[model samples]
Target: MAETVFATLTTELVHTRAWPSGHELETVVFSPIKGFCGPRRRHGRLGNVSPDAYEKTRHESLTHS
Candidate 1:
């Protein structure tokens, strides 16, 4: 997983004519990491859906019961 993500990021960064400054680069790198580690990240254990989507679906099911 990490290798795949790194490869994709590397490919993207290589194509860019301009890169972010030091501080901005930090933000750019961590933002996606943060999202990938948070509730919004897709989970294979959750049938490949994001945690937010899984929660919303579960909630709706309970509410409609």
Candidate 2:
């Protein structure tokens, strides 16, 4: 598992989406200055998600619609 993950992580697969929770979910990594989508520039510039207002908005939108 580690080998596969490392291989995948090292590759150019940075930029994706996901569900609320799961292990077998597809993912993508981003850079600090690439995908800015929040009020504070710092929070929006992460390869990993921090699960804040943006996520809530997305989840609510998906669930309701």
**TM-score of each prediction:** 0.45, 0.25
What's the residue-level lDDT of 58 in candidate 1? 95
Lowest-lDDT window of 10 residues in candidate 1?
Answer: 13-22
Stretches of candidate 1 above 4 Å error?
A: 1-32
Q: List the residue pairs that clash in candidate 2.
A: 14-29
* CA-lDDT, candidates in order: 0.80, 0.51
- lDDT of candidate 1 over 1-65, digit per residue (tens): 98998898778864464665667766787888787776787889999888889999999999999
Q: How close is candidate 1 to the true structure, as a TM-score?
A: 0.45
What's the CA error at residue 50 for candidate 2, in Å? Answer: 7.7
**For model 1, what is the error of residue 29's alpha carbon versus the real structure, in angstroms, after optimal superposition?**
9.7
For candidate 2, the TM-score is 0.25
State the local distance difference test value for candidate 1.
0.80
Give RMSD to native, each candidate: 5.1, 13.5
